[model samples]
Target chain A: MRLAIMGAGAVGASVAELASAYGHEVTAIADSNSAAIDPNGLDTEAALATKRASGTVGDDSPESVLEAEYDVLVEATPTTLGDAEPGYSHTVSALERDRHVVLANKGPIAERYDEVRAHERNSEGRVSFDATVGGAIPVLTTIDDIGRSNVTAVRGVLNGTANFILSRMAAESLDYEHVLAEAQDLGVAEADPTFDVDGTDAALKCVILANVLFGGGYALSDAAVEGIREIPGAALQLAAEDGQTIRLIGEVVDEEIRVGPRLVPETGTLAVSGTQNIVQLQTERAGRLNISGRGAGGDETATAVLGDINRLL
Target chain B: MSERTDVRAHTVRLELDDEPGELLNALGPIAEHGGNLLSIFHERGNRTPRGRIPVEVDVEATPERFDRIVDALRQTGVNVVQAGAERYSEELTVLLIGHLIETDFSDTLSRFERCSSASVAEVSLTVADDATDASSARIRLAAHAGETDRALDTIREVATEKDITVISPLTGGDAV
Candidate 1:
């Protein structure tokens, strides 16, 4: 398979590395600033080395990568809300050119799923975005396997950073700021951390899951999102008095998608600690199916992206 | 296929004014909402603190039909005390030892009640001679089939937060 990856971040770079080792041709690779393109397949090792040393994949612009010959376009750009630009435009262009798309970017699929599906409808190439929701957990694929009609509800502890902070706060009886700082020091949280802490990340994942399940063209803005920012230590203490532990849970029931700190029995499957993610699917026939794993990492998420590429093959 | 194939039995408690035709009036709404009556316990001699007659009605209907029955009862001004008695197919027993009363035993019990797949079947609490001393509670929970582990997990979670020790039932396979 000939591949073009638009974002040279951790996920894109890792996919380029793994797919090359798997014998796929890396035809084009691009960063926000520059791009490297080769119709005969670029050298994956040389491109990564150049990115490490020169801070750009190559001097070729992003437009050139979109124009280059490729069988599939891997969208690994950073997520954004409105229009989901750059990533969205890149995806639209690839699908228009009759190339399959596998997304590691949550924004485009989450914000403009209807438009992406419309593009997939007109093109010969389809879109696969297993990494968009649950990292390596295969959530979307599991829903696919179960047949979407059997799935009643999809809920989970989707954000590892939020789960880490809440789990530490509950165990150590510490305040949010203290646990968040500890998480930051351990590199489990980004420095800014607003997206994870403010619940937008989990809400976006739930929105994507909702669209996949309901197919009613649900968008990120349609979700009822609440973060753990205002949760006080005293609330945890009070909940402990009632034998309940608070976890940041993202749930999608039909068209309603919500994300916030919810009181879940700590012994339940969703009460995972550290940087772990869990997805639970309520099915009409199979009862409740729970799947948990590492929700993020360059290589971990790239594993999902590569899996989508293999399915395409 | 019959509509009764997936029907479940649910019990609803009602508080009615001690009057002539109150029981008959309440039965009308249940039958009108397509519920088949299983049994009824109309205690006319008993009076609640509010001086109302206590009645328990058991009816069989699908979940959606049951919802409509409860709504119709409320809309018609029938004082519905409790909507439904949660039922489950399997049971598990666990002993919780700690400051059960101090940490709010009712709250702990309600946590079990809140789980959709599990319900508190019965509870027995024992307190030490000294009022301030520790206590223990034997809790029996009814859960849906194949969901005992999830129910036990909920109990374990609540016990952990309250600093209580739990002795759970033998849940076969991987005892360790």
Candidate 2:
């Protein structure tokens, strides 16, 4: 299979690493540099080498990214609406050219799900963005297959920044800033960390899930967004005293969606033990399906990216 | 697109007292005049030198509803510093430079709602690998006829408060 990646971020590079390992041809890798500056877009081997050399990735060079035509296009850019980023054009362009798509990036799909789905309908394409919403939890597949229609609601400890901070607060009694810095250092959180700390990331992820599992496209305004910055450390302490841990939760009730930090009793399943993500899928038939694990580890993300690529094959 | 001769949208720059309930008070008129709330992204944590928080709200209402929302906000003792309607001729594009992944780029879009008149037609992102860094974006701000410039201006101002850079085509070969 010939592959084309739309972004060169951690997720994108990881996907490249996996698909290439499987003996597929990753023809091109792209990023937001409209200039197309670097000539040699890093190959999987080269991507790993680059990361090994500097402990960071360097792919999406102009020459290597636009190397050749591809059998598929992978959407791996960061999620944002409108002209704020790159990859939407690359995805649409590949679709227009009749390429299969595997999406790990959530922005275009979330912002223009209808438009892109229509594009998919018109192409020889199938999409799997399993890594987008649930991170390493595979909530999308779970919702799509195993525990689907019987599902009632889902609550996510979606943002790693917020979750990690909460975990550190519980374990070391650390403040938000210190834990946040640690999260960044661990490469589990974004530098800005606003979306994770805020309810925006989880809210958007909920909208994507809701649109897929539920019906009408959710109104962002209707889906409340409250970041974790305002959540005082003392609040977590109080929750801990009550045998609970604070988790930023996103869920749909009746129709209205809730996104905020809440205290879950330690005895309850929803109470996250640490920064690891815990997603509860409440169903009428199956009861509660709690998906818990390390949500943002690099290897975990890479493996999920590989999983999406396998789907492409 | 619901474009009326009477109602047009303008960017309202507000210096909200860094306190709770202030946002609710500021939003009275917007909801009252049937000013369909397009989006309101309050930088609750980012305070101005005056110790007030900056808030940028985009509304899609008829001219009357828009004015009423503005008026309502003022009447509630909410400080309304700047207000002007946006008239656009072309849909412009721009890039946002910052830790977009870190900033929850999704919330930024939540601040941009969709209405029959104008909405965010498209969006894309480029995340860096190291993760302790900034990403760039190319956004297409699609708006009603003669409303593009104002939309761009409002979005740029919102980016400023969030500490993100806006890269776009020049409007009128000058700042709006």
lDDT score for candidate 1 against the true structure: 0.82
- State interface RMSD in Å for all models: 11.1, 20.8
Q: In model 1, where do residues sit more than 4 Å from their true spots?
A: B1-176
> On residues B1-176, what C-alpha lDDT tens digit does candidate 2 reach at each position?
12322343455778898677878778776766787666686888898888999987767655566667777787888887776444323465555666766776765654543332345544656565657655656555556577666666677666766877554432211011
Evaluate model 1: give its TM-score. 0.67
Which residue pairs collide, candidate 1? Answer: none
Tens-place lDDT per residue, model 1, B1-176, is 12423355567889999888888889998899899887788898898999999998877677788899999999889999887655366877666766888888777776654443465666666664566555656666777678788988888788889987565532220111
Per-model C-alpha RMSD: 13.2, 20.0
The alpha-carbon deviation from the true structure for residue A218 of candidate 2, after best TM-score superposition, in angstroms, is: 3.0
TM-score of chain B for predicted candidate 2? 0.47
- Looking at model 1, residue A266 earns an lDDT score of 55
Q: What is the DockQ score, from 0 to 1, of model 1?
A: 0.04
| Number of the top DockQ candidate | 1
Off by over 4 Å in 2: A34-43, A47-67, A82-85, B1-176
- Worst 10-residue lDDT window, candidate 2 chain A: A33-42
